[model samples]
Target: MCSLAADLATLFVAFALANLLVIGKFVGEPAKPHGLVMFAMIAPVYALLAIQAGVYGIRSLAAVRETILRACWAFAQAVMLMLVIVYFGKIAEQLSRLTFVVGVGFSLCGLILLRPVMARLIPRMIGEMPAIAVVIVDSVPFTAPTGTVLLDARVLGIDPVRHDAEMAARLASAVGHAERVIVACPSERINDWSIALKSLEARGEILVPELMRFAPAKLDEYDHHPTLVVAGGPLQYRDRIIKRLFDVLVAGIATLLLSPVLLLTALAVKLTSPGPILFRQQRLGRDARLFSIYKFRTMRSDMTDHAAAQLTQRSDPRVTRVGAFLRRTSIDELPQILNVLKGDMSIVGPRPHAPAARAADKLYWEVDDRYWERHCIKPGITGLAQVRGHRGATNAHQDLIDRLQSDLEYVTNWSVWRDLRIVFATLRVLVHDKAY
Candidate 1:
């Protein structure tokens, strides 16, 4: 929020400076450009780009060099977008060439200046926020306070191969009490600890050797240690509102347009199957919340309730004739539009899994511990993995891993435009034969 406000302020400053450069002084009554609407539209896109670049992330953990680099990257991206908008929007005539150049230069300079200002203002506004304790596993010297706790790597007893009850409890207690946690260790061990602490609430950070080599491309540096925040989910307050609005608009329109097909599918299922027209199952959603997801019934009624509880093979006998066609054409998924409207799902995201969803005759969560990370965002009707042809029964361990990678990528790098792209890709694949 603060970064966005700063960007808006800097935009005005750039406008004033541009006026100064063009008219030799601020005009008493400035002429409104015909392209002012284009400028207004481009401003918010710039802010989203800035946020994605980590402009508004935890400032305490970011080094000065990293902060400046993000600012430059975000500014450059916003400027390029502005250029495209001006050319396509046919608003280039309103902006003098000199004013455009000066405006771009001034905005970049303003953003660079705004960073240090924000870094200082953010701390003061919070007013003595709680400080979390730090623990170091390695012998390497760090810049933490003089009395920070230093523990041996083996003390945490983090075993990737198996669980140690006592070690787990000990490590949990240490991090549970702190407002945040910093674990300094070798790069290889960071992954093990991260997976163990995946479900923890406290904001966790890993202290690595160098400040610039952190994963997520958005880590912060505190006292010379680059820290990747592992716990808190990324969608911020305003961003959430924006995403919900997008879901409402798209889902509402789709539900109206697809009502005929939905009705026809329901009729076909009722006639061809003895059970309910819709199959309702509990699936995990954002933050591990449970929600009932609805889809067209795709299995015969006489089969036990758990018939499709496992993966459906290529030509499963349990599948009714109508169900097979519905699944192949993805018509069975049309009812999930209602789920999107109800806020249980999104138009695009990581696809939700049933509570007992299975692959290779085993539960999905059992296949990989990292699978739980897919619950970080609202499950979507169509997702990055599904559209990329990773949908269907996971017969191989590598299949789930590949899908998980795509899901996590969508979570860490989410944007409204990206969601729209996924939606379009899904439409392109509606006729494809991969879903069944």
Candidate 2:
């Protein structure tokens, strides 16, 4: 995604440079014709390159490698096409090849260089972007102290504590001067937190938990205290039922539609390798229920058990040539549609890990309690994690954490539109080698 942004920025810079040169030549009494005409001629080619490269709609941070490759490919293709048009149209003499080459080269280099510099400088930039006032309260001084340590550096403006009524009044005054106010405090002191929360809540203030420090487990540990008995129950049975129904409907339809591809994949697996057409393995499902998930066999039958659980790195000995291709394009996962049809999976949810994959188990369990909450929904053939480039391997602890976060985000913001968006995103990733 950053690469795509770089490509667009490069294109914009190229157009801007061309326009500036043209304007200087024309308006400053030089030899050039209309400035606007030159600007129009260059801008359309840049826009075309951006569109072909899929740069315009890229998110700020996602699959960087694929985005860069796509940008480079699109730029190369655009340059070649532009050169052909200019040469054949008898305008080659009018356009300076040195100037064109320098413009393109400089623009690409500038775009590629700007992203890392901007990323490094973003913390400093946020202060200049927008400002918000935040107040923190806690019964334990250490708890509030920890809050300051965990505070987001991106947030700007004042932070006033509950201990000072004078600062609290100043905070109130600053609230109107600021764009927004955030309150972070311990869930244990509900009455005290509530009195403060209610006053803020009454004033239409937004409240967010300092989840990084005092997680749900810590909050639940203090829930029994008399002062912290704020009321809220688990998810309603009706809502759970509705979610299950939707999952079944979507998974069922997907299985039926993709049956042909699944069949062809099975045949290909059987023909290319001397092994079971489908690889079935035990995986922890919803609520830690054990279920067998299916996939087209991509590895040889002689692949070691340890290697099966471990990640298949690039150019691994176990992966057959066909297996490598299948893995790269994710055709190996097509058989999981059967699991979805059998009610063992959903069309979109958390990607299930093999029960024997101890590496995955250790990393996933290290996170906040809500890490396991992903199991509350059925496992999926394609999930937010898979779409976001979190699938295939568990080399880093952060990867598992990111996957769990995406899974939880999908659950919290569950909607038909969100599900469709996830499906489209998954398709976009699948069309290219975003994952292994």
Candidate 3:
């Protein structure tokens, strides 16, 4: 209903704009713009672009920067199509270059501007929409403080509780007014949360763990037992065959093209340091297997084992002059193409962790059991974790945990196109030092 209506509106708007540009350019009559033909052609094209850009769903509220970037891409695709049409139809002479250019430029600008304005206004209008209120009950109010810190800036109307009584009162009130209620309590306070939730459930209300809270630590505090439920095995043989074929094809091609850069990096690392050129470390691979991961040496060989395992700080003393430059620019990881070729890794997957990183006591692993689930796939030379500003040493537990979450998400949504996109994104971030 409403969702379908909104989707249709977005599709129609984009199509109409694209059509105006095409028709205004092709229509021979200068005074008559052939608006009808423009509408017919542009509407379909716009709908296609909108769907491809993921503008139909909740992503329609993407930021100005994202909107502009997507619009530019859509415009480029449209221009390519128009060129093909004109070439085959012999309509180049009939089209007005000025009109086409102006029309595309106007449409792109309008769409980009429209999104940011809508992003700002739409939330206010939808603020009253159904929301899950998280009641944080703890003896010391630890859960409450942490819950407040975890509030997503984008979502509206999340209420937090400080004590059991407060949680009970809030839960009763929300049962009367809100559509849902989630209780976030410490591990020791599970009894209280369960009791409160049961009381609400007795009155017939929906409660789900997925919408409970933002703090991963709070969620993990409750679900501590390993519930072994064997559902389906790993990918079938046919799927594995297809995936491996793709890996080899892409890796082989990439190795051939990137050989020169790899050679130069090796030479640079060797000349920059007195130690070995390649830094080979034991890293956990798929199914918890160990593999030797390769990268150009970016630190002194004399560095202590503790220093190697610890996160490197900005302007680390162990970093050689050339190593600093290489690390910042990500030239140090260029040699990992050999890893890709050797079939020890993929071009895109979870970034492998050192063997020492497997300790569950580590802050990141302590956050959730799913943290190690990232190892379900081959570690990537460059991944969503690295591209999203998660590189270097993690100073805080939350940093590593956040990076792990992104890594798992990348694995769950893996695709060849997504891998290519991540590679390009890594390059852009490295060049700009956006992830340092």
Candidate 4:
């Protein structure tokens, strides 16, 4: 919060200076009050983009160069958004070009100047973090991380499986004020420790020597000691905020702009079929949580497959006349924009698969265990796999494999720009051969 305030302050000062010094009192001319409107438009945009770019993140606070780079990157994006809005709204003439450039330049310089001060002050403000780090040794040969307080499970009488409230409280007290707690236990006790750690306020890690085969995302360093990160949330808090914001923004706009099409589609489905206009089915979402996904009803009411036991094939007999056309043009998916608005989906992500969805004769997860990994992020109306022409029938195991590869690739390398690219790319494949 302090970081946000400091950044806002810097932007405000920069705008004031640009208006006053560059074109105001210093130039012997009255300041243009209207020029401040640019500051109003850009400040919030910069703040949101700054959060997404990690401008106020740990690395930014720790390193001056990283801080400047991230802040500038966010500022540049905000400027671009401002320019687009101005150009499209035909307000470019109303805003002074010189003031815009000078203000932006001053803002960048102000951010650079602000970093050194923040670098020194942030640590003091946050206090010495990980004020306590605890390592619990549970019947395992372990080299404790440096600067951590070591506690022997046997000596402390800490039993992770004990359901007694007193036993849980005792273990909690043992690691008071700890920012991170790493448990080194044999394979059998890992589950117990994991359950116990879930109740604690501190970040938990388990030392599993056997997990090396999987090649975890990255090894976290605890005073130079490495530990695998197996249970981290797919998106960081900042990323979740940014992604959700984008989802809402895009979904809201799409809903408004596409309302006419949606209404026509719904009316056609209702008139052509003796059932509801929407088809809702449970699909695996982030972290494998099940959520009801909405789509325009395409199949006949009696022929609808709620479980999605069978994949839709080209010219499928069950599809109604209007439904076939909707599927062909991908208009049947328009209803999912509501899912995005409801927070059950994203505008761009891996497409969700029904729980009983199969590729060939095998369930999706059975085809490849990595299939579950795609659910790390929210499912989307259209995705990397779909845009790459991997939609429709999953007739063979390899067909699922190809799409899974793209899905996982998307999950691992996600960015706002990548999402935008995938969205635009989707425009080309809306009428693809495989869609039906």
Which structure among the candidates has the greatest TM-score?
A: 4
* Candidate 3 or 1, higher TM-score: 1
**For each predicted model, how many residue pairs clash, with residues at least 3 apart or on different chains?**
3, 0, 3, 0
lDDT winner, 1 or 4? 4
What C-alpha RMSD separates each model from the true structure?
9.3, 19.4, 17.7, 9.4
Worst 10 residues of 1 by lDDT: 160-169
lDDT of 2 by residue, 1-436 (tens): 2333445556666645654564444332234333333334554565555554554321322444554555556566767777787778887666544446656666667655654555445546544432333333333332332222223311433232232223223333333322223344444543333333221211213233343354553333221221222212122333333445566677678777877877787778788889788777777665445678877677787883432457667677877777777788888887777787677887777787664453444534443334445654567888887788876676766667777788877765666566678888888788445334
Off by over 4 Å in 2: 1-235, 304-308, 358-363, 367-370, 432-435
Model 3, total clashes: 3
Clashing pairs in 1: 61-220, 61-221, 62-221
Rank list by lDDT = 4, 1, 3, 2
What is each predicted model's overall lDDT from 0 to 1? 0.70, 0.54, 0.55, 0.77
**At residue 5, what lDDT does model 3 achieve?**
35
TM-score of 1: 0.55
lDDT of 4 by residue, 192-239 (tens): 776666444356678766655555543775544446444343566477
Q: List, residue by residue over 160-231, the lDDT tens digit for candidate 3.
A: 222222333344444432223334334554443443443231111212333345444232222331111111
Total clashes, candidate 1? 3
